[model samples]
Target: MNVALVTGGPGAATVGPCTAAPSPDLHYRLPSAFNDASSKNGRAMPIDLDEVPSRGSQCASAGKRRSWIPGAAFLAVLFGSIALAQSPPGTPPPASAPADLRQSKGVLLADRPDDTLLLAVEAFDDGSIGLVVSSLAPRCRVPEDVFDLPVQVDRAGFQLKHVIRQQQPQPDGACAESIATVYQAEHYWPLKTATAVTLHLPWGAVPLNEAGLAYLKSITPARPPPALPDDAATYSGLLDQLTELLAAGRNQEARAAAEKVLPYFVQRPPDEGGRFFGILGTARRRTSDLSLAAASFEVGIRLLEIAGDTHSLGVVSDNLATVRRLQKRLPEAEAASDRAIAAFESLDTPGGKASLGGAYNNRSLILWDQGSPELALVYNEKALALLKVAYRDDPQALRPFLEDNKFLRKAIKTP
Candidate 1:
């Protein structure tokens, strides 16, 4: 059995140190029941990853699903054809496909043989997640490579560069020097973990050959995705996809997707109230779904402790508080702001400090709305103080999140 750990999202997967140890059942793929699975602090580790096929297995088991992976042979065919540019005419392509085709890799779920090698496992506040064939290549690159000439830099930019520097390929790493191909690093990552890790290829392209696809498909089956909230604000999948789309510059599509998914929260769907409200709130606010947005954010905050991310509860609380403050809902907003501020301030990481300060700035908005400009001033002062002491010297480290001059004004306006 093999597992690969990956993280990104609003909540932190770093919450529990329960043990990276996989259960014995997970150590090897058994036909039926998995062994003693451990749930850290009561929340099962989203220990998502895939188990590669054991080399010693009989040839039959290595390529066929019932023979090996339940539906792998099917995936092998699709990806095989795709890898060789053999797609039949009229295959659907996502909007970013043509321009980004050579760089994209994704899993295909065709009905022919039925087995698949791709699975998306998400753990909130950590990172969006997915799995795919090891041989699949990635099209995404580090952001700084946009210049026609080498980007000019000095000590300051280099210092700021370390924030996400480790993500770049290193001299000794397995990936090739060229940005166009990623075969080397994929071969080098340890895909064998006790728990199964899912593979997440790009949407328009397949990265491997039939043999490689078939081999990866033979690895393992995914546990079904967890129950999703009916409301739009808190829907993990929608938000994750939206964020990815936004980053990829497919904004029009993301806006449409958000509009389709987030409204269920506005009316409070009976079957899934709290969950729906949260996702709806997030969708509304972020996608300009403002009127009912604050209400949705509040519901999400209320559902936090029961949800996978305790940290996001804090984030939503702050988010809802901001919307409420914007709309003149003073009392509820103030209480929410207090909770949000306290939550971020309690943690020690640089992220925690920055988020905590953001909470303060958000709180000031509420105070100003509540007819207490004086208190608002105090909170603004606090936000500026934190930013200066902890982030100003290397503010560029904030990158795409806070690089705009308009955003920088927060620090100067605090006084």
Candidate 2:
């Protein structure tokens, strides 16, 4: 049995007007733990590639309740810059792997310079292929058309699949200097299918080994491209429905809906998988299923890393701390919260402060549980101060913090 000291408040979504307004999916408003939902309006926020990712959270009193972190669903064209002239279906005959691709160390393409190019091939499940020419230096520039020579891919000594020269910036920020030139290869390779192939770059020929084949297979295949609704409102309406379901305590339903809509997000710039996993993690945590909840958040972290969404990554990290705390892993929870605070504090964006506040509040709980009431009070006060900035638009959003302040104020005075 659960002691419902304070009821949870609602989550917001940004859906189209097509659907009926959703019920108040109020997040729990207590002092026990903090809720870090990514959106403020109780709906999903738009995923802006230009903006760093940030999420929203609500807090509740001293009791077990769901941590609601709302994330906005975004739909955008994946690899819009590259025009993939769809490849023909059918796996090419397999041949022995080549030695060049098998080199433990990536062969450098450029001469003695600050930057070097490590050539690699990335093939996705959707049959979209790209030759990634990654620049080794952190701040280096690669040529706009890096692969001008006649590139070749042969399966069992057969060549001549149509290749394009659509050079584009690497989506992942970790490799800020990397560039990709997409290719439409024949047939999609499943995860772990080792095939003999060669990349005929102008600098030299880079052959792939069976291990290289497996490496390409291991790369997180981009989600299959989604056929975005012709009407933005329809998409919005769909997002709204998802939010309402999650807010209404329909955890399983929300997870199912997120999975169903996932494939369509493939090829998009933002890591939609990260956002969806975050949503699923929240729903699972609410149900007190800690193992599954942690798994979901872990996956979200990976996807965000792949997407290079620093802001969203911070938001997810903050939310993970709350989940770890609920699982009674105080040390892990504290570490996660600290990491989240660091990430958020690095951002100058509007959403960063609120995220930082939520992390501080979460860390406060861990400290309080560890008998550090004084430190807890300090963090609690910090949360209140920062959250005030985050929820300025909606005074109602700050209700839980106000309650926390009242409680912490008294608790600090007790000693």
Q: Which candidate gets the maximum lDDT versus the true structure?
A: 2
- Which 10 residues in a row give candidate 1 its minimum summed lDDT? 157-166
Give the residue spans of candidate 2 off by over 4 A.
1-189, 192-241, 247-249, 259-270, 392-395
lDDT of 2: 0.46
User: Estimated TM-score per prediction?
Assistant: 0.35, 0.44
What is the C-alpha lDDT profile of model 2 across 213-319, one tens digit per residue?
Answer: 55566654343222233444444444455556777867556544543343333322335546655665565455444544555566566567676777777777776
The Cα RMSD in angstroms, rounded to one decimal, for candidate 2 relative to the true structure is: 19.0
Instruction: Give the lDDT of residue 305 in candidate 2.
Output: 68
Top candidate, metric TM-score: 2
